[model samples]
Target chain A: MTAKQNTQNSLPQTIFRRKLPKLLLSLFRSVFLLGVGFVMLYPVLFMTSESFKTVSDTFDPTVIWIPSSFQLYNFKMAFDLMNYGQALINTVTILIPSVILQVASCLFISYGFARFKVRGINFFFGLLIFSIIVPVQSYMIPLYVNLQSMHLLNTSWQFYLQALLGTGIRSGLYIFILRQFFKNLPKELEEAAYIDGCNPFFTFLYVTMPNVKPAILTITVFSVVWYYNDYVLSGMLLNDHFPLSVTLTGVSTALNNQLQNMAGQTLGADIKLLSDAILAAACLIVVLPLISLYLVVQRYFTEGVERTGIVG
Target chain B: MAASTEQKTKNKPKRLRSLEKQQRSWGWLFLSPWLVGITLFFVLPMFQSVLYSFSKILITDNGFELESVGFKNYLYFFTESTTFGPYLTETIWQIIPSVLMILAFSTVIALVLKSNFFGRSLARAVFFFPVIIASGVVITILKDQVMMSGSSVSDMSPSYLFQAPDLVNTFSQLGIPDQLLSSITTILNQIFDLTWKSGVQILLLLAAVNNIPGSFYEVADMEGATAWEKFWKITFPTISPTMLVVITYTIIDSFTDYGNLIMQMLQDYYRNNNYAYSATIGVIYFVCILLVIGLVNLICRKFIFYASE
Candidate 1:
């Protein structure tokens, strides 16, 4: 067919005419996408660049994209002001165990929804969806009052307990995702395990769980990031022990206090540059770990997203 | 042999019933965690919140006391309060445009990224990076920096199509309606914020697009279908279910967004020891969100394609 078309017209002209629109379209797409990519990355890059800038360079319009000179003092100042080490430890302490517990509990709940034939199961599932739709703030005041009465505030137990019960932030969505993944799995594997005298619990642990690793990973990533980024819940719950997110929010005041203690000066009108730099440094410190984690697990992140979407 | 087979068949139904009962027990057992969670975290709190919304909550050394007010808080919100009405309207306005913009922008971007173009994977990673660090703290910090730097946000971040002012001017010269012009500029001005929020939606859409069976496309190609035809015919219908999911997610996310004015107002009220008012506002906001979600689902239901089992 191509040879006949070539005979009907000069081959080179025909090919050029055929390819011209496609080439133009591809070029347009590439430029547009790249431009959008730059826009997406600009804030992070700006944050990074500003984090290292000296107070003078931050205000210098000429030094827009990059710092004229990289200064380590801002990081040092931010670290001391934000109590970066302790906050990081606090964040990890709260996030890691909660992520594990949430993932495990959600897996169990989703497995039940996916595999078992229970009466009124759809009603129960509707409750899960309700949990997702209702905003946390609506119930937060009551939850806070209850926790205060129980003296459960200012501890990791609040997060851990919720996670264990499969009610932590976005746990409903996680369960929904995992349920879809589990439903799509072939029933033959579980049947085979059952025929070999495996109980349901053992079958779930050894058979179903292993096959849904991608979904598990996806939920874990989301759980970790969401918990890490959470401020309102953590801020309300923990008073003495603040996570990186809560600490970052208070960095400005902390910086002001530190300046007052060090030089007997307030964060008055003239201190915008130093304050901005310090805040940017604190923001970077807070986000660095998650960024590195995402970079390391980029492949699994994308795969998990794809798998969840398909199953969902 | 016939007597034995009949006996076995009779036993099979009883055995199956027992097995079904066992499965039901196991299912409830597995769901025990969620049941407890729902009761304690969701149901109890929701009940308490509703009660609190209807009463005046006074905190004392011993504990808090709730005195029944019976719709006074709701009345104040509706008739007395000056800020709630505007804030609610502002939130509704914000929700509609942002959700629509995100859906449109993300679907197009996902389609573009779905194609096998050069550096496509890298482009995807770039688009998805926001989801990893889209915390309220980070966004607030970045937004503050952008404001402090004395550069317009549109200048710092690329506008969706063109600078709002330029687009508005051109459209005005072209005699576009005032209403249309203002709406266009409002959406364009929100392009930066919309882009950030669209990251997850884009990923979801990209995944959905990729999930379409290749055979469908091959068949379309064999039929000499144009790219546009293929998208409208094959791609759109196949991905509509995921599109519904994305729309719901986006709506919920936008309503509860940290930067939302209503949320900020509610937080302020709560901080100022106005628990009843805060709870009232929370419930109102929640009902609004539910209405929006219901409306969206109803609209999308006609188009969503659920594959028959």
Candidate 2:
């Protein structure tokens, strides 16, 4: 049909007008994506390269992508300095419970919102959105004081309390995401369960819970990332037994601590020179777990987000 | 529910009330945790903070004391505190264009990501890499490294590897108003930051686009719609609702961002233990955010095309 119409016109003109821009547009898109992707990945690649760079490599202008020599010692130094094992342990101790509790509580809360639109639920939903925002800095001091009074300031209990109660970091946003999933679910499934004389609680457990596994996995990944990446609260609250995030900001101090333990004093001179690579190594070590987790769950996470129909 | 509580009063209305009670009770069972959590973690703290904002907070060894000062703390930002006012204005100004640019960038990227292309997964993996490092502490650590490496952030921007701008520089070199120049230059310098921040928004818009019904596009094709026309007619309307979600999310995300200037201002006040002033700053920021979100929601909702069941 286009050939008949295009018989009157020159074929090259049709191709140029119709096909050229389309080809150019696609070409532009691919280049844009690849270019932006490279930009996005540059820091990671830069850090990776920097983590292995030696003293000589830093001064070498040509050594952008790779170093002249690989320095594995930076990893060892960063690991020791960061107190990696202890920090990881502390992080996990806080992380596991927060992820589990936040997911469970948010799952329930979101289900409730999705299932039943009672009077004033909108108000509470508004409040949930408010809580997602409303900068934590505003009320952080009072919260600190409260935790201090309860003798939970330095303990993991503070994290637990918030997570268990569905008020942890970004919990409201999780609730919002999960609610979209629950809301989109067919009502017939629940009605069928109810017709079978299944009670609401049991139906929630047996019927609704299993269907939202993708969302649970997504939020689980999110909660883990958030809690693992959390330093502000942990830094303010904990006086000792700092998590990976806390140690991250103090990699230099960790280096000092490592040296002090071994040599009875920090070798302050040349500390900056040595720290560049060590800092890069520490960043890699810190984010390695999260990156792997995201990689493993990314396919499912994307699918889950799509299925939730993230509409208005 | 099978056995109505009031045996004496056997009526449909009574039974309906009981069912309503059952539904309400079950719903609240699931919702009560949120209620309790909000009360303890949010309402109380938020109330106390607002009160603290309106008063003078004395950090006594035993506990803090609040001396009511009316609107003095609120007044401090405009009338006295220099950083808070300027920083807040800067942040508000930055957020408007930042949000629009992010939305447009994300929408395009999301379209590309969801569409079939060679090495798409690799591209996605690379694009989403920022989500791993985009958290406040990690990104700050990276930025600190960049700073410590004896290169200014703009000179050694992550984008500098691929993007060497001549036009941007030429445009900026051409005299513009200070406010517009500052904003544009700042944006030019922050291309990497802005692009990096698009990771989450891209994921969100990708989800929304993926959620679009295939039938809409098929129908558009049957009607001989061009790609651009189909996008504007089908994809645009279908995804308009999610645009609201993205808008709200981006606004909150940008405001609550770890490296935010206003947050830093609040931090400085906080480090000095000036709780009242910080509270005022937080409140003002909070109100500003609410206003922005509300206004955007109102505007976007009017255009939203909700697909009926």
Please count the clashing residue pairs in each candidate, in the order shown: 0, 0
Those runs of model 2 whose alpha carbons end farther than 4 Å from true positions after fitting are A1-22, A184-199, A202-211, A253-271, A302-312, B1-22, B147-183
Model 1 chain B: lowest-lDDT 10 consecutive positions: B152-161
* Residue pairs in clash, model 1: none
Measured against the native two-chain assembly using Cα atoms, what DockQ does each of the candidate structures obtain, in the order listed?
0.46, 0.43
Report the error of model 2 at residue B134, Å.
0.2
State what share of the real interface contacts each candidate retains: 0.54, 0.53
- State the iRMSD of every prediction, in order shown: 3.5, 3.2
- B120-155: candidate 1 lDDT, tens digit per residue: 667877888878787558877667553445431224
Q: What is the TM-score of chain A alone in each candidate?
A: 0.86, 0.82
- The positional error of residue B149 in candidate 2, measured at the CA in angstroms, is 4.1
Q: Tens-digit lDDT track for model 2 on A59-109?
A: 566666677876698899889878899999999999998889999998988
What TM-score, over all chains together, does every model reach? 0.87, 0.87
DockQ score of the complex predicted as candidate 1: 0.46
Scored against the native two-chain complex, candidate 2 gets a DockQ of: 0.43
Runs of candidate 1 with Cα error greater than 4 angstroms are A1-10, A115-117, A149-151, A180-211, A260-269, A303-312, B1-22, B145-178
TM-score of 2: 0.87
CAPRI level of candidate 1: acceptable
